[model samples]
Target: MALRSNPTLRQRRLGAELRRMREQAGLGGSQLARALGINPAHVTQMESGKTGISVERLRTIAALCMCVNEPLIEALAEIITDRDKGGWWEEYRGRLAQHFLEMAEIEYGAHGLSTYTMAFIPGLLQTTAYASAVFARGFPRLPPHEVDLRTAFRMKRQHVVRSGKTPYSAYIHEAALRMQFSGPKVQAEQLGSLIEDSERPSISIRVVLFNVDTLPVNHENFTYLEGPIPELDTAQMDSGLDSMLYDAPAHTAQFRSLLKRIDSAALSEEESREFIQSIKKDMERNYG
Candidate 1:
């Protein structure tokens, strides 16, 4: 088969795990190639996600590497074999950046998700007006058509949360709640929407106030996507124009720890609802 020119994050992750398995078994690339009956170049391609691996081959790899983690192996198998199923995000593939589609795919497969934001609302929870404002501020400024396209893509991403099957938790700073990307009216509506979302059993919205002594991490926006197995979890960091995904054990662990700390520093769901309500009322009074 023709090798892939651009592999998705999940494909790369599966490849990475395969490489790790080989290393754990103390087998070099050439050595593993001999064991797998493939050339060294083929091994390299597999490890770089430039090629696909069959389930039988994956099983052979696990057996050769002496990997007994059944769940992780199962998860890896799913990743490699599930490529044929195209997601709704595929429709936007040529129009949007690859990261956008990858994010949607990641969210769709996530068992649960947790997000932290300092300056803006989490994308999954943003309203159309608020999202449009946020996108409008992009450097080089987006055309109205592009803004609408991006906004639609973002709203589509929310489907996973709206399905009520995935548990979604967002830890938003007080500053984020106060920032009126468009204006107070839009911000107020966004806050009110947050309150309504919070009432859902699967959605949790927590507010972190400015009074906290210090934050565990810098004021970056990130989302932690929980996979079927902890080892497969991913952390995605977002800057307005770009996003980076990290699946390395250390990085994901650090993100997980930081998110936990943020969770602790945040108000309880009920308290956060009241807090958001207060902010909405303030906006209405001052700018209604």
Candidate 2:
């Protein structure tokens, strides 16, 4: 069996909470270990996210820390238990990075998701052909099979939007609507697909037009996910080199501000549909 590489987000969060509780109780690792009848090193490992904690141990620790809220304790316990089990993405483990896997799991668990794209369509909305073309261009040296696997993974993620599990909102730039990474035909198809998907009750698509002077043009891609707990809301920013996930209140607030700016600059639903249809007509005329 493959050894676990590092603690997942859930594990990390739980570990942080445990450490916080211990510190609040004014107990050091050794003291807590003695009180719980566990080894100091074991307690240290759990606090550092280097070791997993069982449900029973978690309850004992919570009680020892004077935690009275059953809901919060249960939530933390769920994170520990859930992390131990394999998620559906485990099947595609070798093909995708750990960050992408974590994002996929979080997306599945989110109650709502909002995205802003400046360059290209977000992966969740891209058609297979569009996704393939984008991946091919970005990874020119990648093998065809690898590109195919990436496309498949992206396609699978779109289910979250199609199904009613999580509501999603997207704000896209007008440039992206006109940009043709693949041939015009593929681009046109992608735009049409977006329009159709946007009509879904759980999906909202708004386009920031070129004439919108209020729009912020800092070219960055971001995704914000909201879960059952307010603290679980997170924002992800793409830095070209890598993606960074932010959960700090300040960072999340900044993302929320950016999203609001984009939303304010974007065309309304009817206007966006008209704009997309106009672009599709032009693509047909030029390419067909």
Candidate 3:
């Protein structure tokens, strides 16, 4: 089979998981290749996601690595056999960075999502006007057409949360609510949208208030996307112009821990709504 010159995030994830398992098992590429009766270079390519592995090969690898987690094994199997191709995000292809497409798939496939942001409402919960205002402030200043495309893309991404099937929990800082990102009207509308979304049974919105005491300096924007199994979980943080997904077990655990700590400092769902409503009223009073 021809080696893939470039692998999508999902494909790369499969390779990464295999590499992790092999490391945990204390086996190197040469050893694995010898045992699997495949060329060592092929093994390298497969582990790096440059080559596709058959379902049989994937299971063989897991068995060799002695991965005892049935759920994780099944999840890996499903990932390899994922034939849905992709949707929506594929359309934007060259128009946006590949990271956006990867993120869309991540958001769409996430069984649930836990997000924490210090300066903005979670994108999945942003209103169209709010999204436009945020996008408009993009660095380098995108053209009008680019901004519109991005807004439309973001709106479609919101469907994942609005679908009401996948649960979403957002821990937004009070500072984010107060930011006049797109001006007071846009900010007010955005806050109102958060309150409205909070009503959905699958959605939980909390505010990390200003008086929550000093938090750890590590608190930054991140979204933990739940995979079918905990081992498949991913932590996403934005980098320059693109997003990065961390699938390592340690990284996943660290992000989950941070989320717990952040959640601990956040207001309860009811309190968050009240907090947001007060902010909205204040915006009307001050910005109007």
- Candidate achieving the largest TM-score: 1
Question: lDDT tens string, model 2, 1-288?
Answer: 232357776676677778877887888999999998988987877876778878999999988888776776777777876776776777887777777787787788787999988789988999999999888887445688888988898898889988867889988888888888888899999989998988899988998877878666464588999856665568888886577888766777777888887877788988988888999889988788
Mind giving the per-residue lDDT tens digits that candidate 1 earns over 89-115?
989989999989999999999999999
Give the better candidate number (1 or 3) by lDDT. Answer: 1
Runs of candidate 3 exceeding 4 Å displacement: none
Per-prediction CA RMSD (Å): 1.1, 3.0, 1.4
Instruction: Judge candidate 3 against the unseen true structure and give its global Cα lDDT, from 0 to 1.
Output: 0.86
Candidate 3 lDDT over 215-253, as tens digits, reads 773746889999998888999997556777788888899
Candidate 2 stretches greater than 4 Å from native? 1-4, 20-40, 59-71, 216-219
Clashes of 3: 0
lDDT of 2: 0.82
Give each model a TM-score.
0.97, 0.86, 0.95
Q: lDDT ranking from best to worst?
A: 1, 3, 2
> Sorted by TM-score, highest first, which candidate order results?
1, 3, 2
Clashes of each: 0, 0, 0
